[model samples]
Target chain A: MAVTLKEVAERAGVSRSAVSRTYTDGASVSPKTRKKVEKAAKELGYSPNALASSLTTGRTKLIGLISNNFHNPLFLEVFDLFTRRLQEKGLRPLLVNLTDETDPENSLRMLKQYSVDGVIVASSTLSPEFAKAFHDAKIPVVHSFGRFASAPDVHVVGVDNVECGRMAARTLLARGYKHIGFLGGPKGATSTIDRRAGFMEVMGQAKGIKVKESNAAAYSFEAGRTAMLKELKGTHAEAYFCGDDVMSIGALSAINSSGLSAPTDIGIIGLNDMEMAKWENIDLTTIRQPIKQIVDSSVELVMAALEDSNRHPEARLFSCQVIERGTLRPL
Target chain B: MAVTLKEVAERAGVSRSAVSRTYTDGASVSPKTRKKVEKAAKELGYSPNALASSLTTGRTKLIGLISNNFHNPLFLEVFDLFTRRLQEKGLRPLLVNLTDETDPENSLRMLKQYSVDGVIVASSTLSPEFAKAFHDAKIPVVHSFGRFASAPDVHVVGVDNVECGRMAARTLLARGYKHIGFLGGPKGATSTIDRRAGFMEVMGQAKGIKVKESNAAAYSFEAGRTAMLKELKGTHAEAYFCGDDVMSIGALSAINSSGLSAPTDIGIIGLNDMEMAKWENIDLTTIRQPIKQIVDSSVELVMAALEDSNRHPEARLFSCQVIERGTLRPL
Candidate 1:
């Protein structure tokens, strides 16, 4: 048995409307009456059901947080920040794991059933259309760690992967490595494609520089290791920019197994300076994607859209910088 | 504007009761009427609101998935398995990140507000009373990776940390390590306490075997490294069974920085056999805690409790085994 608002009102000696107003957000209630209602509610162990109140307010305060990559350690930080920030804003995250399913229609339908106030597609690998599906369904949506565009169909918050790639290339070249390589993530992923373009763009213009490029099956350690093993078999470059931090760790493992060490026999750099990248053992030099800022900005945009659904869509991109460690050779 | 069930009923030329029955689980509706309602609903773009229907059924199909340690990588796998498994069962995971908060009262109040159908407390470090709070509030709960109790206050699913500790001690003894140590997690965690008891029990019985014991601040890499670095300052044990894999990797890092290496100047073993433990760069010897099986069983127990709220509390413990790798010396 649970306590009801009417029972709390009776115990507090207040009208039902007063009790309801005390619980509703942004509703006016006098201090004396609100204190009485809160005391009675606490005594009766009554918590207004969010779902029941949502029927009246049409705001469930539930945000559909969708992500496709769970294997990447970076996402753990992503999830931590998103959940905490959303919680701080009095919103709950309905975590939707898209690791297996790819169709946006199914997710949109599920979110619609729950009547979530908005959706945050928190994945770089997921296409922009995935976030658009929510928008088309009349749901406020923001894509975190998504691709940047001058004009966007939905609110986008993330880093410039293309610039990150160019920066990685330039970092390697500045280290005086005549032959450099790019080890990207999955071939079809937008992040991989964009980063590869930037890497090629910089390396192609360099004089007397030899460059090689390849992609791993996924942005995973095993995939990077597997791809690197193949590269080692056929004259690998002097150094490589291996996708994200996880993949770079995998590539470093492959190099170590091949009787080679970073900055001695070969050099490696990664993106997304995740926590593991700075491990005393891994000590991976990486491009730091401002994950906290991206997640916070995404939450802000979604909250704004919730207040006014007609807000124009925009892309907010944060810059990345090289976090020098042990993996890269000194310039 | 969103479509409504009444519109779908009107479009299908069926009674409103027929449309509602078609969507309600286990509600009887004729095959022809169900087909008509489904087709009309699809055409009208009507998705039955779960929160609205909860008013009638009193079930929201939302599960509060709570955890305290997001920094530990093992939890990434835990979250992935829990989210996917909960989704397969048509339940949405309301992820509660308690990385900062520790008060069970706050979480209990929050979950009650959401009216979650059930709760899953997935953490070894969290106190047992945390799960008990949910049970006290008449919320069905299952604690994954929790300490084992023959008479659990709630459904508990995980390994016996004490036995795991014994196994780790025996494994080290078999490797001919004379001086051994137990570097546990936080001193207050039940996992750390039970694991220490088991480790001391075995080591205490072995005559002429020296045993040293300490604890990391938390089950994290930095804590492990810091604790191990402190140990290395004095006459360190010949080998150590760190709290978990992440800590073991940290201890290894400390040893490397100290100009010592595993299985040569020292030995190390860990628990949880997390993904990173098997990385080629790490190759940490560890005890395997079957994470998938634990998560699946926890879900099952919580679901079963949802169906029969009067069900008696039960504890399901899985056995853990040593996964031999490069960290420990050979037998």
Candidate 2:
């Protein structure tokens, strides 16, 4: 027993077309008629069905937000920001979890069936080809936290992981850590590859500094702990730069379990200063990625592409900075 | 640049209706024709648009997955499971973030506009009325992590928070903690209220066991830390049963910052054994709320409701158990 638009139109003493126009965005309707239609609609508890009207406008106002890394705590912030920004724009976020998905063809087919107006692929681990597949399927797509390219094939928004790597390496060296190591996330992730490259680039130039590198199976606490435990078995470095905050916390747990404390026996730094990084017990000194800005820009880019499918693809990069906390040793 | 249905039909030497029926679920078509249509569609890169087909079927197959607590790590798992399950059913999840939302009218209106087949309210903090509103609007609704009722207004699936509270209190008493405290979530949340009721109920029965009660503004690390810091200014309890694991971790941080340690200087037990609770560095003893069971049941209820909107609403409840970890003192 839902109220119908016809009843609302009859109650408002307006034509059905007028009532439809009043509710349709960018449709022509007088202010007085719009007010009358809105009042009647509210009184009758009538909500215009977006799906029914999408046939006329050919826009569903639904954006597919695809991601694969739910285990990473950093995604909590990413999902929050993406949903909020999309809601602000009156667009609904259709969350697509690719946790076990590898083939872009299946994802592309599924998203196509949903007829999502655009897509925001929010994952660092997902390859660029994933976003490219959506674009090739005639869907507007933006890859948030995707790799940067000199000439991008799709709309990309994220930080320079390579620069972040070099920065982490230099930060450790400047802190007088002669023996340093890079504790990275999964070896397959582009983020891990780029960050590792930058770390080695800077470490290779330094003299009298020994560097070691290894990767966690995933960007998770358990993986970090497992990888760090193996490193501790051998000659551990004076300091280490973990790939991300979750991994850093995991590595920290491994250190504490071995009766060693941070900044005293060993120092550690992480990336993506997630909320957990500031917790007093896990006060990890880390690099802060502009998550909110990146998400907002990704939404904006997708919306723009939706309006004009022919728009050239571009990369929007944000800067990352170090957040000083309890994990890093004093100079 | 997209292949049309007519092109695929022509290539397969079949009628366009046959091609369309081939894409529609459960639509009748000959097997030989289906094979030919599928082969041609694959070669022509033809994908049927879900939005366009919704005009005929009146089903978008989009379910609204609404949540309010993005900061709580438990939601990460909830979202992951919900999305994966929905995808398996060929249903899309439209994520509705009610983190900043206070008005039910606005949220209900937004969901209606999308014409979602159903709505799943996956939050313990949101009021029951939120789900009722959707049901009242004739939208199939399921409440996950919601309070259990003997007669539910809508489909309800989760653990009995009151029983969990009692479980925590008994665990603490068993560990010889005489001076105990209840660190709850927001004051208005049903989970917090029920948990407090059960905790106080158990403590009231036991003599000579002093119990203090306080609430964090939300089930978040910062809120938990802030509340604990305030409590620490005065005489603190021998142990605390936090409303959730994230808050427990926050309280643990506050205790550590005050030169105190858990299980020795102070004891802490949390509810919802989130992934972080098991982290070695934050080995939080917590009550494990069966998140997977709750989510799976919620999905089942919502899907059932969708198939038969007239189905009687029911409440499904799961039991909670204490997971022994490092946060609480030994017996």
Pick by lDDT: which candidate is best? 1
> Candidate 1 - CAPRI tier?
high
Interface RMSD of 1: 0.6
- Against the true structure, whose TM-score is highest? 1
lDDT of 2 by residue, B57-118 (tens): 76778899999989998999999999998888878899999989888888888887777889
In model 1, pairs of residues that clash are none
Cα lDDT for residue A230, candidate 2: 97
lDDT of 1 by residue, B238-315 (tens): 999999998999999999999999979999999998898898989999999999999999999999999999889999
- What DockQ would you assign to candidate 1? 0.91
lDDT of candidate 1 over A33-76, digit per residue (tens): 99999999989999988888888788999999999889998999
Instruction: Write candidate 2's Cα lDDT for A54-121 as tens digits.
Output: 76677888898999989998998899999999999989898989999899888888777767789999
Off by over 4 Å in 1: A25-28
